[model samples]
Target: MKPEPVILPCGDSALSVELGAVIDETLNGRVLALDALVTAESPPGVIETIPTYRSLFVVYDPVVADYATLAAWFLDRANRALTPPKPGRNWQFPVCYGAEHGIDLPFIASRTGLSEAEVVRRHAAGLYRVYMMGFLPGFTYLGGLDAAISVPRRDDPRLTSPTGTISIGGIQTGIQCLASPTGWHLIGRTPARTYDPNRDPVFFLEPGDTVRFIAVSPDEFTALERRAAAGERVAEAGNP
Candidate 1:
């Protein structure tokens, strides 16, 4: 039998429904399922729902809904069998690997005991799931990394990582939406603007989306970056 979720209050206005302690897809599925249920029901005073790897953080108006009442409400539904939400969009992003674009490619290859080409090949071949978005705007945390290339985070994190950085840390891989400090081992970069405030949809990727990386040359990366900067949607949407 599945374990019951632990409902813990976050101050007086928000609560966290922890489904599991690990980063398993089943647990994440439940989180998303609960998010869908709560959103569909539109519970009174519920302000927002944020689904993470294995928990759902629900923010509500404390005046309209007390913590005890809301906790009981989430506990009942979280323990019940839930229908998983439909899969989100599939996206194919063009990436430029090795050399300056992916400065840590050699280090990652050495650590993983794989050739540089093999590392890039394995990374590009695997289909990744967008588990959640956090840390920064449109910074997507992805699941489903190729185990052969998986490695621990960098011992020394860089002060700044460029936007469009594709990296792997621990058992996961992710796409960096903006230039920021990161501990993940950089393997490549994609020109697609996952987050663009000026664009119609500010965020391109969302939780539950599947992503594929396509290797591109430096010239192609430059061309794509230009197009992306000009407000063009550079990433191609794939069929579900």
Candidate 2:
């Protein structure tokens, strides 16, 4: 059996529930399960809940709730055998690898001792889990990368990477929501806008969603990008 989680006070209005010291699916699942339970129950004074790799940061209104009471409540829930949450939505994103889109393809292949084509093949083949949305708006930190192709992050971080950049760092891969500085190796580019403020749903993907990459040619990428810019939903949605 798993050991009970440690609950600690965060300032005067928040609580930090430390689930584990390492990053694992089971630990993350428990965090999500607790988040779901809290959401469903609508506990008083809960302002927001942020789930990370191994902990849940719960913000609350101090005026309406006390730290000790909330900590105890969260501690009891975290230690219980939580019912696993329902599977999240699955999304298929079109990715154009190599050439200008993935300038680091050759480098990644060299580092991993695999051909460029093989690198792309392995990357697109895995079904990645959206462990969390963080760092930037709609930026997805994904899990389930193929260990064979896993490589370290770039020694020199880029000043800015284009939106839709697909990259890998350490044992994980991720999707760039917008143009931003990144240290991960650039592998591909996707037309799917994970975050678009003008769109109905500002964030297309959420934590707990699954993602699959569909390889596409550069020509196809241009066409899909045009469609996406016109506010079209380019990524295909799969049933959970």
Candidate 3:
């Protein structure tokens, strides 16, 4: 049985419920379950909830609900055995892993002592889990990478990394939905817009969802980019 999560004060507007110290599926599942439950309940004065690797941050209005009251409520509900949340939408993104997109493929291959093709194959073979979306809008922190291709983050951070760069850092792998500086090793890129301000739903993937990478050619990537820019869904949804 899992121990009761510790509820701690987070500044003046938020409270953090720590599920565990390590990154594990069961711990993350509990965090998601609590999030889903509260979302469904729609408690008053709740601003928003942010779920991370092993904790959930509950933001609320202090005027409406005091810290003690809110913390007690969270503790009561968090202690109950919550059925794991139903699996969310599954997504498959077509990635171009050639020289142009996979900027650090050769470096990663050299460090791992694996051929470039083998590295790409191992990366594409991962069935990643969306642990949480943060660092940027629609940027998902994913888990479930194959151990063979795991690589450490770069010692020096890049000044700028292109949007849609698929990269790995330590034991975690994620899709960079926005252009930002990062230390992860970029292995590929996708045309799909994980965060589109014009779209009805700005975020393409949510926590509890699953994602897979489908290798595509450079020519195919160009076509997909055009289609995506024209407001089409570049990433296809897999059956739940």
Query: How far off is residue 60 in model 2, in Å?
Result: 1.3
Q: Using Cα atoms with residue i matched to residue i, what is each candidate's TM-score against the true structure?
A: 0.97, 0.95, 0.96
User: How does model 2 score by TM-score?
Assistant: 0.95
The lDDT for every candidate, in the order shown, is 0.91, 0.89, 0.88
How do the residues 1-240 of candidate 2 rate in per-residue lDDT, one tens digit apiece? 686699988899888999888767778888899999899987889999988888899999999988888888898898889765766899999999988999889999999999999999999999988888888887889999999999999888999889999999999999997999999999999998998888887777867788999999999999999998988879999863
Give lDDT for model 3: 0.88
Q: Write the per-residue lDDT of candidate 3 for residues 29-122, one digit (tens) a residue.
A: 9899999888998777789999998888999999888888888888888898966687788999999995989889998899889999999999
C-alpha lDDT (0 to 100) for residue 198 of candidate 2: 84
Give the range of the ten consecutive residues with the poorest summed lDDT in model 1. 79-88
- Per-residue accuracy of model 1 over 39-70 as CA lDDT, tens digit each: 78888899998889989999999999998889
Best to worst by TM-score, what's the order? 1, 3, 2
Candidate 2's clash total is: 0
